[model samples]
Target: GRGQAPATGQAPPPEGNLRARLTSFVGREEDIRVIGDDLARARLVTLLGAGGAGKTRLSQEAAEAHARVGGGWPDGVWFVGLAPVDDAEDVAQAALAAVGARDTKLRGAAAEELRVLAELTSDSDPLHRLVEHCGRRRMLIVLDNCEHLVDAAARLAEELLARCPGVQVLATSREPLGVPGELLRPVEPLPPEPALQLFADRGAAARPGFRVEDDLPAATEICRRLDGLPLAIELAAARLRLLSPRQIADRLDDRFRLLTSGSRTVLPRQQTLRAVVDWSWDLLDEGERTVLRRLSVFAGGCALAAAEAVCADGRLDALDVDALLGSLVDKSLVVAAPGDLGADGMRYRLLETVAEYAAERLAEAGDDKEATERRHLTYYRELARTTEPRLRGRGQRAADRLLSTEHENLHTALRRALAAGEVGELLCLVHALSWYWQLHDLRAESRHWSGAVAALGPDPFA
Candidate 1:
């Protein structure tokens, strides 16, 4: 009875229970161990990082390891990749289907076929039933790309954790799902050593006799220049099929330009590292894209206050700034970091690649770009103007923050304003940035701005 199967033609049970094992893994032993350890100790673990950071691969490794170790639960490991299914409700259905759960209420043949699962299985709650079927069985359920429906993921995780004691969930996302009992593992970029190793490995696979000895330094340089990001490194290595490692290193000097080629079969956006970023950019609404491009004026990071001041020219309300920043963070276009401000909570920055893409978008947008740049310059110029009077007061910090964030943008805007024959705006900009120049010991820049204004003839405001 234990080994026999019914009339439906399902095969008989195996002679011995054979656990699944991962056949190969590369460059992420430490990460795999960390996630595996967390899954062993906690009921839920979230692997959080930017896109293409190998969350899926790491989760697979951990699942395979759990299957091998034996004592956690005997049922087996189940992984459901949620990337294709966008709806939250469908996620549960997909998981149920993956675990052989069937519903019986349908009238159509297709529905009946699906319903056979529920009729055959003895468990009541589908999710709980799936877990119970794996009773005393250590099961790891992976929820990949949870960032899209974070709230839904959190609710589902809570339900599973509450009802299914034997099940462990390994979730991977761009951001954390903020669930209790969820251990967040932030995945950093691959380390330089393994990154180079990966490059050599892939390169050798593409071309024979691709040794590391001759190309080690150049390979290392490529990794460093690409910020040790795996996807970027892989894309670089793909070029080694045609170019030498040294030539690849040389091309990386203008990485934005050089990192154009990607896998031929993949989606255009996924083909190259630039395409990945461009895909994210394409997903932005016009308003968000505009705000993002305007934000590129800042070199460092920007405060909500500064963003509102510089980015809002009657286009976006000040109240919308926070929400916009949050959206950008969720989209991976902007990153949140600790800030020194007590009033506002955090500072936000763009990745270098994202910033460059935004800058290009701004330049292409023509008059809108110039107009937004004017607003940006005006805001910083006003900040500079206001700070001079309150150098000894609290305003100094605000001024300094603005100056630091908007310095490059301010410089670019000033040059553009002068070149556009907006002499009045140029004078205001020069006068406003004077205090910033003095405070930051930028005497040369201050002199330059002052000369530009002077050349514009006598200022009407003066």
Candidate 2:
């Protein structure tokens, strides 16, 4: 049977009648329209995109528009932000409390009271109640930042969809919840034209005479460089309040270094795109941080097998990579992607900014960079050597996966070895990466490393 409503024989508490208000919405008209249409149709929709893709903003805009359209949902549009809550079960309780579920009547022993409250709230659970409440009435339920509590969100959403036939759900997350009736709206970065307009508009608002002329081209270039991500562009604009557009452009030339300045008013996580990423990084445990720093060696995505080979040391056992990698994904630091490597099944990649941050930490640790480089070189070199003979065999995929994952770190190690006069190690790594270089059309790098190795007076091994 469908779950019973609150046992508090009393009537469900009064709905907060608070009209949804749009604080601000920018550069996502198309997204707003798409989601607004879904809400009008009472379809369950999920907005899937990377962090800072403005999923929350889009969801808010959809809610406001639905409210404006002749009170689309009779129960009224309700928003439950889940970013602060970590525990899954607590997520449901928070949602209930947010929607005005009264706990006064839920009395008994602590456990029994909770059970009573859960049942009471369960029936009045806005999502559940929204169905009967809808009865040809229309309402919108907005769940924001649900990636952290996806299981709970999924269960709640499932329950709501099954019970609340007339209600529409609009959720924002970094990924999709694989539930029936879920329509995925993939949010892309802002297009160049609107992105430039947004930057100019915001800049003018911040500084009255901020013009976009010769600097317009530079500004456009800056926006393009940031991949037209709104949060990144806005951050670059905020710096203009203190720096000239040209100066901003020049600084942005090294985005990893320059993008650190954050907004004064925004949450630390939302200050700059980097800070947003750092917030996620700061939440990781020591083991997770160690795994991330080592994994940073990989420029492209890597499979679990390659990760185990490269990141695992005496401190971290081979078996620990899976659990650690899963944690990283949960923290949104490392992202999983599809892989061509058959046995490993999935591949992972670090964002460029995250990789740079990890690399900086790796260098700052005062560990013997050379020794670490040696371990890195030797691991990849042996991997290259073993996999080279089976270029067309099953082993080729594994070898290529390792080489691709270790490409940047391998280059950095090779350069360091060459600088430090470790000629033998450099030669071994160069030879091992040969097949990888060829397969990935990185012949130029191979040629450069080969030339560097040859410049040595003699093989250091000799």
Candidate 3:
């Protein structure tokens, strides 16, 4: 039964076993529709996002939806999983197996071609065979988890698109395949309504008769804290058998460990939130890893200047910060957005789960966490002091907007100041942020911090 090809008349196992997922799919209706539209037009469409952001799940749903509508992929859909692959050379073989395309003849031809076209050909080339095998059939192929073998995946997609005009590829990866003419659809977190619905559906699985509407506010809070990440929300919902929604929300501050227990039926990496992140983390180069660990000192996100200030240590360089950050962003470990943090044009952030993992790594590397924190605090503190004067008179609104953007960082700095018992530092932050607090109607918080300063016996500066 093992080595036999399907009988000449057999239908070839209904599109290559796209893996019968055990969990119920929820949300992403728009993603499905948009991706389906893209697939109809483009030869290669990649669903890109951070790990656990549901790129694979969303792509699977999209492929199924496209198939249901008969979007011209008539030959069949095939799924090539790259998670189990380590070397790039293995990519072609994995793809051939997924499509049930015999490569024995082509393998021999490839060896001979390498001898003839020694300077122009690759040894053991599988892409050429795959392209020839599928040349006559219109089909959809899903390349799952292409981050580790991005270059090979890109090359394959490029060649397939160029040679096999009848082939359409829908790929899922943390980054784009970077091949020409690739359409990228970034998978984002589920919206609140869909997120809550997903939470309810999975929660009921964990505990029958579980109702989300009973404590709507608490349930909503849980989704918000987890950033509506589907994997995280699913993991949190799985704990409904033992923990309340409120309890889940409360423990999310240490979510790296809190959300570790996931359903056993999924992949080992998918079995825990941390494991999913670890899978991606292991793919980074040393430079990217070092930058990510240092960037964890930030709370919300930081400007390029702020990241360079805190992250440029012995292991990383200030000059290389931009390139390193770009690489992290490319891998979906760091997120870049247009914001007011600096003149560098974009702000970057790690997902909360990712940042927490980086923090743990920073601790493990014997890196000085205190020194990193101090640098972050010092940078933001100086930023606040410099911006305080600018917040007055004509530049008030611009200064206010800038401070609003960095509000989380400022609060984090103040918390660090309090924890370190630095009375003078606390006073400076409280004074600098006073107008910002008043502008934002945070008088209660202002009063609380000022009260703490008042209880410090005497002004250290005085």
The C-alpha TM-scores of every prediction are 0.71, 0.67, 0.86
Q: Flag the better candidate by lDDT, 2 or 3.
A: 3
Please report, in order, the local distance difference test score of every candidate based on alpha carbons: 0.69, 0.67, 0.81
Those runs of model 1 whose alpha carbons end farther than 4 Å from true positions after fitting are 1-42, 62-73, 86-89, 100-136, 148-156, 176-181, 191-204, 207-227, 244-269, 278-290, 313-315, 340-345, 359-368, 389-409, 415-421, 424-462
Q: Which residue pairs does candidate 1 place in steric collision? A: 73-137, 73-138, 74-137, 74-138, 75-137, 102-118, 103-115
Candidate 1, residues 1-462, lDDT tens digits: the string is 111111211333221122333223457766766666676677888887665566777776655554454425445566776666768766665566665531332355776765686554544555555545444545667777777677777777787777777777888877677878889887777887888787887777768889877867888888877766677777887787788988988876466667766767545545777676675675567778878998887766777777887677666787676677678776656877777655564788776667777888889988777777677767666765666666557777765765665566667768777887788878877876676677778898888778877887776688
Off by over 4 Å in 2: 1-44, 65-74, 83-137, 147-165, 174-197, 208-221, 224-228, 249-268, 272-274, 282-287, 315-319, 338-347, 360-376, 383-410, 431-448, 454-462
lDDT of 3 by residue, 250-355 (tens): 8888887788778776788888888988888898888888888888889889888899998887756788887888888888889889886356548888877788
Candidate 3 TM-score versus the reference = 0.86
> For model 1, what is the alpha-carbon lDDT of residue 155?
74
lDDT of candidate 1 at residue 417, scale 0 to 100: 76
Error of 1 at 62 (Å): 4.1
Of 1 and 2, the candidate ranking higher by TM-score: 1
Error of 2 at 452 (Å): 2.5
Kindly report which residue pairs in candidate 3 clash with one another.
none
Higher-ranked by lDDT: 1 or 2 = 1
How many residue pairs clash per model? 7, 5, 0
| lDDT at position 326, candidate 2 | 80
